[model samples]
Target: MPVIRPRRLRQTPAFRAIARQTRVHPNELILPAFVREGIGAPVEISSMPGVVQHTLDSLRRAAVDAADAGVGGIMLFGVPAVRDAMGTGATDPDGILNVATAAVVAEVGDALVVQTDLCLDEFTDHGHCGVLDARGHVDNDATLERYADMAIAQAEAGSRLVGMSGMMDGQVAVAREALDAAGHQGIAILAYSAKYASAFYGPFREAVDSQLQGDRRTYQLDPANGREGLREAALDLAEGADVVMVKPAMPYLDVLAGVAASSPVPVWAYQVSGEYAMLEAAARNGWIDRDAAIAEAVLGIRRAGADAVLTYHATELALALRG
Candidate 1:
């Protein structure tokens, strides 16, 4: 050991900071927001402590805040006053979500990437994503038609990105064709290509007032099957998805890695509501250090090959990192 100088750079904060391979920035964090119809005031989600079902006014304010903070984007999901067989409220120009989309666009303009959840579950009375067949089972083909219409409506309302989250067969292709035919060529699709049938979506049920009677196994991928997720991502990409995503990101890091490894489009991950709530609850009770745990959650996702993360804690995390 003739003066190897192994400690040359270990003595300085600047030196250690310079060694960061993966960084989480405001631009790398996408915030997911929810809005409700006919709500006079903001309603906090019990399960997701810090999250709220914002009124139209509050939703706009949050959107503006996120945009002002330079967050990558704001992903909006609407909770309508009505639900029906066709999820009619979802495509209505005056529907809560569609209205919120326009409001966000008006508020943020191009300062941020305004995105909307292009799914019927939040609007459907029966909690299915599409029209039920004669047997009452979800009809995948019929669902695609509805998704196509949703894509157009969201784009028309000035949403730059439509998240195809219904897990319907051929949804991305159908939406793409519909958008092109309707002359919405610039609208992008963020396909939730590998959304799983997981317990993590439970808290989301309360967030959206979902009336789901049964599981989404008919469409959503099974959690036990990792290879199937790859197939689904492949299908979404071939169908013209501008980006592909894996839901419940932490539980499926391997799937996230696999999708990112081969996806030509950017691969994103959603740290779903349950994941967020659990961490928050634990940190609240002093089971873990809140800031450190939050940082680890995000860092783990980024390390798993996600180009971007859709997180509920996006704004705070960005601020924490900035400090």
Candidate 2:
């Protein structure tokens, strides 16, 4: 019998490049940014090393930088100076998020997609993703009403895409209805369909100065249920989600793959704060190659079926890819 050697394709860089099944492009990366309402300067998040909460001015600069580097989009998260029980700021025309959205859209609207996080967790006093009832539980219906209003606010503020990350039932449908009714039907919805209540969200709490005293297990998916994730994706798709996302990407790649395989719309993955922190910490300690590890981690998400990846490393990686 003739000898068979698959190793022939692994002999050179050109061969490896030609045989590569997956590629990560600069335009397939989205940068997630935090803009604080009252900050005069950018505040570096301790847990998330290089990630920062930006002043409005700094956020504009960052958006310009991301656009210049050819990043696909920027997901804006706002930290308001005040929080009320109803999360009034989330729907306020002059609220931090709305203002920041307008600013970024004006700065980079022509260059990149400007997306906004349409969740109440950063605006509510209790740090929940929705309004709470008298019983201190998240009120799904009331929150849906709030999300409907938020969608309009974000749309009016020039956000091309509104990310519904609250995990509330019927949220996508409600937001879609409201946006259409308000004649902002051009604004797309990005549903955080398979977002899990993972421990990896710790640093994000600090980035937004979260008021969460307990957990969000009531709404967010449980890490143990992979099948449940697919159900959520189906529901979001039926409700008119333009894009479905699997958050905390690395930990739930199996879930991501399942969603990508079935979803007709684009599927995205979020490399959450914890994932970024772990790799950064190891690299700082000399336990790994920083650039190589970051690239591989994002590439793995892409290989697992993410059409695009939301990452804090988007700007740097995009720059490196272009370089």
Candidate 3:
């Protein structure tokens, strides 16, 4: 009888590399970027180091950089200069997000998929993801009407993928119908299917200059409900979502795996702002090896079954992977 050991495969770097079951490739990463309405220069987000609110000029540069780095795509979020009850900016053709989407598409459309965040939060004065009713509760059906308009706006702006991150019920169907009716049937919808209401979103609020006075737990999935995440993914798939996503990837890897295992469409995950901030803060404090930790963190997400990851580290990690 011969004694067997797994150590033989782990004995060398080349062996480990060859035996790796999951690999993080440049094409499997999407960079999430912010472009502000009136900024002349990029403003670094205090809560998220190395992440910034970009001016239109700076956004073009960043898009070029991401394209050069070979990232699969760039997801754009706009910080509007003005806000309104109806979130008029979201549907306006000259709105900040629409403008940024067009600019990024022109800069790197041929090189990578240019995506837009199709949500009203950044444009709404109330900071809710949807329009409010008479009593100030989010109006689901009314918001769907707004989403339809926003979907067309994004498509006209040259966004190849419109990320429906507002988590509105039936949003994917509404956006799909609106896009097809408007002769923009080629556009894809990336549904944020199982986005959890987590504390992990705190830094993102800062990044987008959020104006919320309370919380979004009413719409976003509760953090404790893993089964509910799967149900949401299924709903999105049935509603014509080209892709479905689980956000705050690391904390919800279990949910990610659940969706990945069951969904027919591509399953993507977001490494949100707080996650990036935590890793950066730790690395800056010398508590962890920055590059190694970043690599491992993303690799863990990839291993958990994300077909692509929306991450702040996309460019850097893509470069490292290419090297």
Candidate 4:
């Protein structure tokens, strides 16, 4: 005699299927792609078994497949052959990420949204998000200038949405003003509003070939705090973020939900490489069913009110969900 009668939907598979309000679709998935400089084949990351660091050719092929699967978008990151103190490569029109973005846009055209990472870590030898000051700390204002330049570069290279993942103060305003002043007002900004400093990014370091001298504790959100996440999102919204994101989606579902509930624009969540690898490793160990786990994780994010999810297993999950 339960007041809610929750068992009504559990009567049968057909009933559960028919009554389901939450669903996973290919158009809700966004694949994270990596393009390295002058590589011939895909290089697998040890921490993430099935994921790879893609060469241009491989990246193009994978993008084609994802587009064919009807994914919502592709998020691009670069691994440059050279790095410097200010991450100068990031702002170069001919840089690895910019060139790759152009290439992917040519390959996919209007089929999917092509997003570019507007950050410095992949281009800096020191692996910080910006130029180091006299004391070797990341200079926020200098970094903002660099981000503005990178925003222009990304827009010029055919990126539809620029992913601002550095968690820098005033990044959105800086980049927005830069892009607008350059007459690239069509370009959108997807801010990593609540990116936390967590152990979850360990695999991404390997994926990006990072040479970071220190942690991102100063810029990224503290994992111990949840209210700070909302504050960051608030700042990003006030600064013209077209979309706001919460990184490492699983551990931050509440944050995602809170942000989505309050956000005026779309909310996205990233299933970081470490999250992908952990689930994959557990599946490989015969501890959990891979497909089920992937679907469940994705569904959980959807339930958390994410408009879209950036995931390493985006293609596979899309295929499975479609079937």
Candidate 5:
């Protein structure tokens, strides 16, 4: 009797919709955008088909679009025109990221959360997430000081959330302390708690024009270690992370699920550059249905217990969801 029964719900779209256990809402999706300094027009990332490094004007327009489409937030990553050993741009009040943050906040102030990427990779000449020591290794404690300064600058720029993606120890605590000291007690920290040193970041390197000569295995978690991800989340949580994220989420769904299960704060997953590129490449080659694959990918992350998702497809998907 059961052999014939399963097909009943599968037979109609309406029935399937009603039976669906997981859904991605526009309000649960955050768009990560890149705004490059010195660009008069938006430039497309060759590795990531639909994603672009925006000009100031385009960034404002994009923020407006994201807000109008009901996206919950937009995370801004700045591509500076120059890079320095100390990543001075990251802490500058008029830095590209800060300016973009101010522009976005002004464009859509209360409509959506404007977030900033509080990492040094895009500003550092070496393309490392932190300052390097005399020995050429990333200096952890020294980097935290930079992050603390960067957080206040972002808060001053009107960012509601500062995303700490540098994978440095005690970053959340340092940033929180600095922000509170500067009278920005309301700004929140979103820690990239379980980010792995994944090959999946290749496309992102291109998107940011990375100058990294070596891998970030020293700071980023190893892809093979699931338990370490949980440990990182716990550490970040204790350090005052308002939200914790798992990066390159598709390959780390198990880690994401584990964190989501135990985390007291909101848990987010990033469908990063490579994930976006893979789907776009496949769709371009007629190997997959773009919309269906995107919907499924995001739904899987949501089903894995992500409270929110950072995706390159956020705006388009949000518009589609509305229809």
Candidate 6:
């Protein structure tokens, strides 16, 4: 007998297909969208090539397109026309995010889930995710109140799921309580449980026109710690997170796998701005096969145990998969 012919399965397409353990589906992908307050035309994010900060009208069209493509959801981030110390726009019923959320929900209806980025960084003048204390540090308890308010605002704006990406301690519990009290009991929470302070967010600054003055090392997880990611997930789950997410998915696959293995709730990952930029840059330089690389990256994320993935490439990937 031949000695353990492992190549037998690898030798044919049918065998390879049967052996494949992971796959990317349109229904498991969510598109991340940026909608700006005062733009007559959609503004392309230079760092993120094909991606753009959409006007309200354009954002509506994009959401409909994503829904028609069979994407699972669209997570909206708003760029307001002004900023303040308290990030008031985050909780304002009339805020740009709220308006955009309403528009998307109305446009797509039940075709796809509409989610909102429940972070204040985009609205704060100082660019921190929360309000600052007299000493200049983020006031954790005070910030929790703001988060609770923002959650209710997003929920009222028609966001089915509010992504708590601020990484604030006790935020999930507080937001959950606020939503329940406001009689928005059906709203869900998608906690950014394992978001890390990575350099990968560089391009996102331009996308949101972020005003961040300093690093978020105090609140965001350190990139070096994998075990901490699980702890954060556990805490968020205990506080009633409907789903837990690991951000900048490619660099944190180990963390993603660990969270997926232990998490009782669904595990999702964000293929952040930097990851998308690298692939685009290489493709533009004729250095890599973009489509194949995109497929491989998303498949690898799914294999690492992500139940869903939020990516800039969601619509394109969905269209390609359908073909």
Candidate 2, 120-231: lDDT as tens digits: 9999999999999999999999999999999999999999999999999999999999999999989999999999999999999999999997899999999999999999
Segments of candidate 6 deviating more than 4 angstroms? none
Off by over 4 Å in 3: none
What overall lDDT goes with each candidate model? 0.91, 0.96, 0.94, 0.93, 0.94, 0.95
After superposing candidate 2 on the true structure, give the runs of residues whose Cα lies further than 4 Å from its correct spot: none
Task: Give every collision pair in model 5.
Answer: none
Question: Which regions in candidate 4 have their CA more than 4 angstroms from the true location?
Answer: 1-4
Which pairs in model 3 have colliding backbones?
A: none
Better of 3 and 4 by TM-score: 3
TM-score of each: 0.96, 0.99, 0.99, 0.98, 0.98, 0.98
Error of 6 at 71 (Å): 0.5
- The positional error of residue 308 in candidate 5, measured at the CA in angstroms, is 0.9
Per-residue lDDT for 182-204 in model 5, tens only? Answer: 99999999999999999989999
* 240: Cα error in model 1, Å: 0.6
Tell me the TM-score of model 2.
0.99
Stretches > 4 Å off in candidate 5: 1-4
The candidate scoring highest on lDDT is 2
At residue 185, what lDDT does model 5 achieve? 93
- Cα lDDT tens digits for candidate 1, 119-155: 9999888898778999989999988888888888999
lDDT of 6 by residue, 1-323 (tens): 88999888898899998987787889999999999998899999999999999999999999989988999999999999999999999888899999999999999997989999998999999999998999999999999999999999999999999999999999999999999999999999999999999999999999999988879999999999999999999999999999999998999999999999999889999999999999999999999999999999999999999999999999999999998
Worst 10 residues of 5 by lDDT: 1-10
